[model samples]
Target: MFKWIQGGISAVTGLAEPEYGESHFHSSTKRLTSKKVNPYTRAVVSAGDFDFQNPSNTNVETATFYINDLETGYCGFAQIIHSNIGITTTAQFTFKLYNNNKDLGFKQIWTSTKLENFEIVDKKNFKADNLTLQWNEDGSLRIKSEVNPESIVDLLFKPSITNGVKFGTDPNTYYGPSIEEQWGSMRHVYHPRCQVEGTVTNLTTGDVIEMTNEKTFGLYVMALQNMKPHHCAKEWRFAWFVNETESLVLMQFETPKSYGNSIVSQAIVTIDDDNETKVIACPCENDLKLLGQYKDEETGWSFAKSVDYTFNGYEIKDNNVDNEVITDDSKAITFELKGELSELIERMDVMNEIPQFVKNIVSGVTATKPFIYQYFSKDLTLSRSDVPESAFRGSAWIEVTYITDEREISE
Candidate 1:
């Protein structure tokens, strides 16, 4: 349950901004003070080794790795979570391997333990019990996990983007604005793109699936939420689209009505080749227009089947200028995902993944529904008014979260 002040609800509803000591929201003239890191250094620190020992016990941090194989149509995801609230602390690791070609749609493995069991060996290495993630000196990642016998994974992540862009307001401070002082702080950093290799062995069936470097691309993300997850955002949508030469990553989330129903978003566009002139890392506002939606009869839940979205706003080029006009009305960028309802890959029911006690606690406090979806389509396309159409034939991951009275449970 959220710890709302006596009049916090009114403040959240646009009456006034919630107060929490000094304000961290920068004015239009004040720019971020953190120094920009080089591409190689970006990969290491972007792993998120920030301070979590907040005396308020509201800090939560997560590191996620997303892998996709274009040729084999296999997608893999691994997440490590560390949260400390008051006197209690929780640490967890989760893995999901999705293979559409296989008879079984996907496999999930998860475990929860104390925070002491997790170790961060510098910015390049992270260990949680039997699972070890090591970023090699050469920039490749060596991952080995023996947490679950049913699904054993050994893989390597080789970054494809040499000059990856770090998306945030300040590189030294939290990823974005300090919304926590008002409502809760939600921040993120993205490693635009990477390539994946190695293998995932199903110990149960004695089967070994080789994950090669052939047409395999990936993305890395680190996120921090400084309050209870339910109190932070009312909804979230994240998408990553990649091809051989270019990659586009977008993240958007909306605050609860109590927080004045505000929306925050960011985007990173990276193009790798000899012909490209400059990389575009912009902060943009996103609008989602739902073209189609599907409601599951059994779960009484609705999800977007197809949607058209656009990201339009100013771009931050340098410290001297905070908001620079990169794309005007005629130069808007838009993306469209067209696919049948039956084609949508239902990744998981996040509520069912957590421990029952925690689930009950959340359910008792607020209304929350979380679902993950993945889509691989040759029809997904991207077009910027300034450039030619770029046909993207790959996979995309989507997470839909609804909180409080905004819950979209159909039944």
Candidate 2:
């Protein structure tokens, strides 16, 4: 759940004009569907897409790396979470390691008086405490940290798809009563299909694993969410599904009912090429549907038992120059994962993750119940429309979130 409400209240208290509330949002999808933007066009990707934004403009920013596979049978993610609240700026380095069975991890937080602990050297670099993330001159990403004793970070993410992906030319969604009265902004950029090199020690077992790019893969994400949680979104759904040669990823969030409860999502599908420069990254005109959901007792939120993801868009027919970007609308790509989720990894209470001050302030005003359901699996069936029924050993990490109830989500 997004904390958009807090930001809205903050702006009001600070005497900012053009109040943000019901009927204020201008959704990106609304723009995309207005006939002005062609949904079937190729995604406009760029090397500059990874640039870091000014921290003062947003409350939270993160550079996260998700390890898709490891020859030693371990996989997980590392994230440097930077947050600005009131007059304090804090950075949290968190990592979780998982295998085919169990999981382990650690998170360490460091706060600075005026962002003295965090440093931004340039477009491709930033340091939050002992963690250093930078892009190399050779189109690779280096993430190193000396923040702890239990887990050490020294990893290189070599992009199989060199250019970062921005779903559309605009690159951001503006929300408010109008463009001039913008109350919030949402942006995301993805670095997918990377060959990860280097090693990170196990969080608990203390075992050292040798790392190489040949058998490993991961995704890097740069995200900015600049509003109070509830005022921004009611739910968020994310999925990263991959095999050796391809991947399917979706990033989505829904505005609260006050903002029309609009759903905005981005989907990407990529096919591998041994030559890094030749890989194909496709941005889909997509829709994701949740099926057969039931109410959970603990969170009182619905859990989706099945998912159907449809990717409709053009693709590079082949490497041949004459092949052209083509699509068969009648046979748009589709995939579904049904039945039991492979593994119920974790159930998170969003309130537990926020600062006590913010918690106290929010608890006093409105009804806010936020929970996240996370699932992970090393082996899950991902079947394309035309294939060997199930063609590959796919790995996935998915999250579904539910926040306060203003209006019930029908689906």
Candidate 3:
């Protein structure tokens, strides 16, 4: 169930709850569900009895470096390059940083975090001139060096403090819209070390293929680094929401604060073939039209009472062969996605524990909250893809949008 905790911030916990419920991080169990909880809690999530991460109780904040280049090579058209690092509330925040420039043919990815007595460096400035990195038997990384805290970047503080901040779908906490807009950039830029690990279950083969990638990107995108929920409406965004035969990719981005607050650039990407990657830059301009929206008493969730959306289609292109992204020259097609606002709100429900007294003060009964999500990309489209011949995966895409909806319950 969706629960928004109501309370003031806890000085000791650095964690806060909404006004009428418990902190999501405290009640977290497993799986990224809509069940209100901390986005960075170290809780084990399970569906049925299958545990997701081993020792599910162990809490570890995940960070990563990502580079989304719509252009295949040299003359890159759109470059969304950045890094992000985050850690949950834990004992010691000690980690070894690694470089990943050659591993992925793109940028840097972290190597390992098995260093001892190593110095913490500033963001973008690493003193690898005298440090030695080693790998451990358990596959964890280790470092050996006479650490110079002052010389090495103190990414957790000062010049590089944003690197250590957590960014994810954390309900109950108002991280602001900027947090959601820059979710991708912050994860890959600020933090010097990061990894991308996941499992790809081939629906056709029924064999689960596992993959773990440790890579780092050097550049930083401010949009990704400084994001948090409740920051502003400028960060709320959307895309055309694309779908294809081999794959589907939806691209959506939040617009920085502006007079016309609306999702400017947002779309999903899908790929059936390995080399093929489709990018949709602006969805709202292509297929997003607001018919009406409203809130209800029972569910207390606001929904698009009516929405008119469109999709600029994709087809294989001839020139894309050398790049092997598509079989034929890319063909753009346009389609529509029109439906009622109720369709988006059918799943919302009121929180029974929320006191009526508090609800009166904060009136948002059907707010989408700060969920920086695009379910049509590799990581997302892959996981949520239910095609009989396809599986699912996840990937981070930059989202920049402008939100200007006065009908919001919270407003």
Q: Residues 206-259, candidate 1: write the lDDT tens digits.
A: 767788756787777777776666556667777776666666677777655444
lDDT of 1: 0.55
Return the top candidate by lDDT: 2
TM-scores, all candidates, are 0.75, 0.80, 0.30
* Ranking 2 against 3 by TM-score, winner: 2
Q: For candidate 2, give the lDDT.
A: 0.64
What tens digits encode model 2's per-residue C-alpha lDDT throughout 1-411? 134655477464221122345457765545554633322222222345677665574367778888866454556777877776546667777776566543433222121112237776676688866778887777888888767655677999987754666655555677776768886777777776688888876455566655775878888888877665565777888888877777777788887666666777776666666643332334334567777778888767877766666655444344223213233342345544333466666777868866877666554444467788877766655555544476555777888987766544221
Clashes of each: 2, 12, 116
Taking the tens digit of each residue's C-alpha lDDT, what string does model 3 give over 270-333? Answer: 3324533222211112444545545534433334444444544333232112112222444444
Clashing pairs in 1: 12-258, 180-185
Off by over 4 Å in 2: 1-23, 33-47, 55-58, 102-116, 202-205, 273-285, 304-306, 316-332, 335-339, 353-357, 386-393, 407-411
- lDDT agreement with native, every candidate: 0.55, 0.64, 0.26
Best candidate, TM-score-wise? Answer: 2
Better of 1 and 2 by TM-score: 2
Candidates 2 and 3 compared: the better one by lDDT is 2
Worst 10 residues of 1 by lDDT: 32-41
What's model 3's TM-score?
0.30
